[model samples]
Target: MKIEAHDKQIQDIFSLGYFQIPRFQRPYSWERDEVENFWNDIINDVSENYFIGSMVVYQERKPYFGIVDGQQRLTTITLMLSAIRNSFLRLGEDNLAKGVHKFVEQPNIDNEAEFILDADTSFPYLQDHIQSFNGLKIDCDVGIEEQKLKNAFEIICARLEDEVPTSNSESGGQISMFPVDVPDPILKLKEIRDKVLSLKLVFIQLDNKSDAHLIFETLNARGRDLRTSDLVKNLLLSKIKEGNAKLDSAKESWNSLIRKFDDASESEIIDSFLLHFWISEYNYTTDKKLFSAISKYVSEDEKNANDLLKKLNHAAAIYCKLIDPGAHEWSREETDVRESLKALRLFKVKQQSSMTLALLRAYYEKRLTLRNLKACLRKLEYFHFVFNAITSQRSSGVIATTYSSHAISLTGAKGNDDIQAIISSLFNSLRTKLPQYEEFEVKFLELSYLSSKTKNKGIIKYCLSKQFGDKFGGIDINHDAMSIEHIISESTMKDGLSSDVVGSIGNLLLVDEKTNSEELMNLTVSEKIKKLEGKGYPLAKALVGEKFPESSGVQDRARSIAQHLYNSVQL
Candidate 1:
C-alpha cells in the first residue's frame, strides 16, 4: 500500500460516497477537550501551511478508501468546503464564478456548457482563498446571511490583491506582506487550508483481495490492546469465515447491540464486561495466577469463543435494562439478587474460603427470600470479624495458628465447626423469623465493647455516629462533633501506667474538640478531670459512678475508666 500527501484539491478528488461510516468503527464524537484543542490548532496554523494527511485506501481491483483515522479532520474539511462554496456564490467574481460552480457540482456530459461558465476550473487556486474568507465570516459576530459569505469572500479577494507579496519583488528587499505573514483573516484561513492538506498521518493499507476479517484481527491483536468489545467483535467476525452472508449477519447483530445501549461509550461497555469476566469466571486462587487465567481467556480462545461473546452480549443487555426506566420493573429483583451474589463472591475471593460458597448454596437450597439472604450476609460479616481478629492478633505476635488447623478450628467449642454451626443456626432463625432488624446485631454486640457505667449508651452512640452523622438528632447524649480523646498522653507516660493503658480503647471518650484542645499536652489526667468538673460537665462523675461502680478510690477510678473503654471496643 502506497502513502502520499494529498493537496487541498484532494477533498474534491475523493468522493466520500454518501459519507457512511463503517459499523465496526468507534463513534464520531471525541471528548470535548479534544475537539477544543483541534479547533485551537486550526486557529494557530492560519499563516503556516499544514497537511491533514492522505486517505489510506485499500487497493482492490476497484479502488476504495477506508479511513484508518482522521475522520474528524475530514468531516471538518467538508463543512469548511461547504462554507466556501456558499461564499463564492455571493461574490460576483466572473472568472471565479464558474470555478466555484464546478467545485460544488459533479461533472456531467450534458452540463458541459454550464461547466465552462461555472467557477469550477479556477477553484483549485481560488478554493483556499474562498474557504479562508468563509471561516472569517463564520467566526465574526455578524448576523448569519448570504451577504456575510459575500463580504467574507470580498475581504479575501481584497487581501490577496493588496497584501500577498509578488514573486517579482526585489530579491534582497524585505516584503512587508509575504503570504507567510499576511494579517488578512482570509489569508490566515488559506494558510490553514494549505496546512491541513499537507498534514501526514500513519495508515496501514491492507490488500482488499485478502480476507478482511483476518487483516482486521491481525491489526487489532498486533497493534493496541484489544478492548473487550473489540475482542467480541473479532470473535463474531471469525465466525463469518465462510460467506459474506454470515459477515452481514454479524454486523447487524453488533449494530443492534450498539443501538440498544446508545448512551454507553465503547470503553465503558468494554471495561464493565471485562469486570464481569474477572469476577464471575476467572479463577482467582492467587492474584498473579488470577491475572494469568484471565489473559489466557483472551489469547487462547480465538475461534470457538461464541459462548463468551454471548455472555458479554447478555450482560450488555442486562446493563441497558438496569439503566432504562422502562425496563426497571422486569429487572429490579434479578439485579438486586445478582449484586448481592457479587458481594458474596468478592468476600469469598478476599477471604479465600470455600465456606462462603457453601453458605450461599445453603441459602439457595432453603429457598431464601431477600430477607433470608440478608441474614446469610450478616453471618458472613461475623466470619469476617473472627477472621480479621485472628489475622491481626497473629500478625502482632499475640497469637498464631497453622492454616490447616485454623480452617478446622471454628468447629469444636472454639473450632471452625462450632462457628459454622452458630452461623447456620443464626441464618435459620433469621429465615424463620423474617427479622426486621439487621441479623448482624448480635454478632456486632458480641464483638463490641460496652461501657460499664454508661451501659450500652456509649456503644450505641459510637455505632450511631459512624452509621449516621452527628446531626441525626434522636440520641440523648451530646452527639455534637466529638473526637476520641485518650485520658493519658502517649508522649508523657512517666507515671506507673503503661503505654497500653494510654492508648487503650477503655481510656478513649468522645469529647468536644474545644475540651480536648483546652486540656492540651501539659494537662495530666487528674488535672483534665478537674477541668471537666470545673466546666460543670458530669462525664468524670458519670465514669466514676456508672463505669466503675465497684472502684473504691481515685487510683481504682482511673484504672476502671481505662478498662471500661478497652472492653467497649472488642472486635
Candidate 2:
C-alpha cells in the first residue's frame, strides 16, 4: 500500500486530474450556512495562504481519483470559481473570465471541456450552470444535491456582486474588500482568481482500494469525528469484498434508512436506530456501548456482515415508526396500537424504547397479536407513569434491564401460551419493585410537580390531559399558553407555613394565564375554592372543599387525584 501526504494548491489539484464521488457516498448536502462560513473564513483570514483541511483521494488509475473525503469543500470551491467566471463575463472581461473558467474545468484528450468534480446527481447541474459563462436560475425538480449546488452558486454570486461589482452592472457597488471605485474591475477579478488558485490544501493519495478504505476509517475516526452511526457503516462497508453483490444491496438499504431519517441529524437518528436494533436482536446494549457491542457480535467476514446488514435493513423500518408513530402505515390500519405508540411518543420516555422495540419484534414475528401489543403498551404506560415519571424510584437503567430481560425471555418462548406467560411474568416480576397505591399517592403529594419547572411538568400535563385524553385526542393542551395556578395565592399564606408547600401538587392546577391572574389571584382560600369549583380542569374541580393549603385535607385530596390518575391509565 503506497501513500503520499503533501500540500497542493487548490488550482493544481483540479488542474489536470478528475475526481469521482463514489456511488455509496452521501450526496452533496452542504447547506447555506456551511457555504457562508467557508466564504467568510476565506475573506476574513489575513494570512498569505489559507490552508483548508485534508483531502483523501484514492488514485484509481492515471488521472482519475476517487474522493474518500472532502467532497463538500471541493464542491463549494468549484461553485465559487463558477460564480467568479460568470461575473467577469457579465462585466465583458472576456479574457479574465476565460482564465477563471480554466480552473473549474479541464480539457480532455478530445479537447472538450470536462468538469473536474464528478458527483453522481450533482454533476449535470454543476456542468450546466456552474461550468457555464452565463448564470442561469434553476427552478426544475431536482434532488437535494442539485438544490445545494444552486444555493451555493447564488450565495457566491451575491457576495461577489456586493464586494466587487463591475462597471456595466445596474448598481456598481463596491463594499468591504475595496472602496467604491478603488481598483480596475478586471484587475480585481484577476486578483481574486490568483488568491483562489493559491489556496493551500493537504492532499493524501492512496494506492489501492484497501488502503483507501483503511485511511477513510482512520481519518474519520480521529480527524473529522465520524458520527457513531457513520462509523458503524464504515466498519461494515470495509468488511465487504470489493465488487461484491452485497455491496450494492447494503448501500441501497443504508441509503433508504438515511432518507427515512431525513429530518433528524444523522448521529441522533442513526444512533437511536442502532440502539433499538441491537436491543431487538441481542436483547442488551446501551446507547454508549452500541457500536462496540455490534462490533463484537458481527464478525469481520462477508456472510456475517451481510446478515447484520439484512437485519439492520429490516429493523430500520420498525425504528422509524418508533421515532415517528404517525408515519407508521399500521397507525392507520390499527387504531389501538396507533394510539398506544402515539402516547409513548407524547410521554417521551426514551428508555421505554426497549419495551416498545420488544413489542414490535413480537408483532413482526407473529408471536404477539395487535391486541396483545396494545395490552403490553398499557403495562409500559403504567410502569412509566407510576415509577419512572411520578415516583422517586426512577432509574432508566432499571426500566431498560426489565424490558430487555423480558425481550430475551419472549424471544426464546415456544408457543402463544409461553408468550402470554412471559408477558404476564413481566408485570409480575416488577410487582415488588413497582410503587404501590399508597406509596405512589404519598410521593405524588410530596412532589412540587405542577409548580416545579422540571421536565416532569410535561408528565403532569400528560396525566391531567388524560382525564379527557380520549375527548382531547391525547394531551392536546397548547403548552405555550398553559400555566400552573395556585388555589391559595403565594401572597396570601397567613400561617407562615413553609414556602415549599406553596407550589406543591396539593395547591396546583393547570390553567391559562388569564384565569390564574384574574379569577384566582389574591383571593381568600374559600373564595378561591369557589372560583376553582367553576373551572373545567378535573384537578381544580377536585379542590372545591379543601380548607387551607398543605393541610391533611389537601394531602388527602392529592392522594385521591393520584389514585384517579393511576386508574385512568389503561392498565
Candidate 3:
C-alpha cells in the first residue's frame, strides 16, 4: 500500500480539507473520564506542542476524505473548539468567537454551513445543537450518542469556568477578597484554545478506499483494543450509503440485536454471541481473534457479509434464549427441552452452550428432530453433571474442542440421521473423558453447600430434587419450596458433627417451608427419622433404616447418593 505520512499540527490537518467520519463508525463514546483526560493532557502540557497520536483517512471526493481512525480524538477536538467559541460569545468577545467559529465550520460554495470535521454518528446533535451558532434545538431524539455530545460540551464549559479567578477566597472557613492582578481569564482561555490547535499528530493520507481497508486492521491494533462489535459494524456498513434502504434496514436489524442484551455491554453481549454462533457454524475461536476470523471469512465479499448478517440476525435471538431460557416460554410439547435448558443453566455448564446452540438451531430449522435434540440435551446434562459438578474437574479446553467440532458437524448436514450421528459421537467422546466410578464417588463425597458450593445457589436442592424429586408431590424441583431443611441443626452439631459435614449434600433435604420450620427445625437423628417417616420419600425410608452417626454417616450417605446419580447416567 502506498502511503504519504507527515507530522502535522491539529490546526494544519483541519485546514487541508473537509473531513467526514463514516456514519456507520462507532458513535462519540468518550464520556466524562475520557473527556477529563483530554482536558488534563492539554492543561498539563500547556506550554509544549503536545504530540497526541496519529490520524488515518482515505480520499473520498476531492478535498473530502473518510476518517479511517482517530474519530474520537477529532470529534473531541471539535467539541473543545466549539466550547471555547461559546465561552468567547458569553464573554462578549464576538470577534474572537467568529475566528474560532470559522474553524468549527466554513461556508461552502452553496453558502450552507459545512463543519470541518463531519461526523455521521453525532450528526445534527453535534452540528445543530452543541456546535450551533444561533439557538439550541431539542427537535430530535437525544440518544446515548447525542447525550454524550451534550455532556462533553457541558463538561468543557465547566472546566473553562474553573480556570477564571474568583473575587473571594475561603481560608479557615472565612471569606476574604483577593488583591487585584491575576492573568486575564480570556487570555488564559485563548492560550488553551491555541494549545488545542497546536496539538501534533502524524497524518497518514490513503489515496484510495482499498488502502484504508488494508491499513484499518493495524490502526488501533497498537493501543487498547477497539470493541469487536464496533469493528464488525463498521466493516459491514462502510460501503453502504447513508440514506439507502439497505443501510437503514441493516442498521435497524443490528440495533434490534443490540437491544436483546440491553442490560449487557455490547462487547459482552454481541461479541459473545458472534463467537459462540461462529463456533456453532464454523471453527472454534477465541474472543481476541474473533474479528480477524470474521474478516477472513467475509473478505471483500458483500454476499458473504449479507449472508453472515442474516445468520447473525437469526442466531441473536436464539443466543439470548440460550443465556436465559426461563425468560422465553417453550411450547407444551417441548417441555423436556425447556427443563433441560434450565438444568444446564443451573448446572453452570457453559461448555455445552456452543453445541446446544447448534442443536437448537437445527431443531428450529426442522432439519433435526425434536426427540434427537432432547437426547442431546439429556446427554449433555448428564455428562456435565459427572464431569463438572460431581467430579469437579477442570474444563481442560479439550471438552470445548469436542463440543465445537460436534457443533460444526450439526450445521448443513443431510438430515436427522446425520445430526444424530454427530450427537452420538459427542456423547461417546464425552463418556471417554469422564472419571472412573471410584474417582467420581470420591470427588462427589467432597461436595458441601455451607455457602455457594458448585457455583450454584440451590445446589443442595438440585441434588435432593434430582434424587428424590418425585417425592415432592409434583412441586417444581428447581425451586427451594421456600426453604431447604438442613438436617443435623445446631443442637445436632454440638453433639459431634462438624459444620462441613452438617452442610454436606447428604445431610440436606428439600421440603415445604412450613414443614421445615414447624416440624424439622432442630431435630436429632431419631427425631429427624420420625418426622421424615410417612413423607412418601424413599430417601426418608433409607435414612430411617440406617443407624445414623453424626460424622461418618454423612459420607456414607453421600457415597450412596453418588452411586445412584452417577450409575443412572446412560454412559
Summed backbone clashes in each candidate are 38, 0, 0
- Higher TM-score: candidate 1 or 3? 3
lDDT of each: 0.41, 0.70, 0.75
Per-residue lDDT, model 3, residue 265, is 47
- Could you tell me every candidate's TM-score relative to the true structure? 0.43, 0.77, 0.81
- Global lDDT for candidate 1? 0.41
Which ten residues in a row are the worst by lDDT in model 3?
167-176
The candidate that wins on lDDT is 3
- Give the alpha carbon lDDT tens digit for every residue of 245-352 in model 3: 456866766677676776454466677788888888989988788888888877766677777877888988888778877778788678778767877877777787
Error of 1 at 35 (Å): 2.9
* Models sorted by TM-score, best on top: 3, 2, 1
Worst 10 residues of 1 by lDDT: 395-404
Candidate 3 local Cα displacement, residue 29, angstroms: 4.5
Candidate 2 has what TM-score? Answer: 0.77
Q: Tens digit of lDDT per residue, candidate 2, span 1-571?
A: 7889889999889874888876545567777788888988887777878899889888768788988889888888888888888777766666767888877777877898777888755655777767765547455545566777878888888887776775345323332344565776666767676777778889989897667766766676664435667667766776755566445656666767666676554557778878766775575877667777777676645587778877777777777777787765774346657656766776557776766776787798888898888778877777767876677575747667777777777766769999898888788866657777877876676666433245556655565545423323254455436566666567644567554466566566666788776877778667766665576444334453334444445556566568777776543
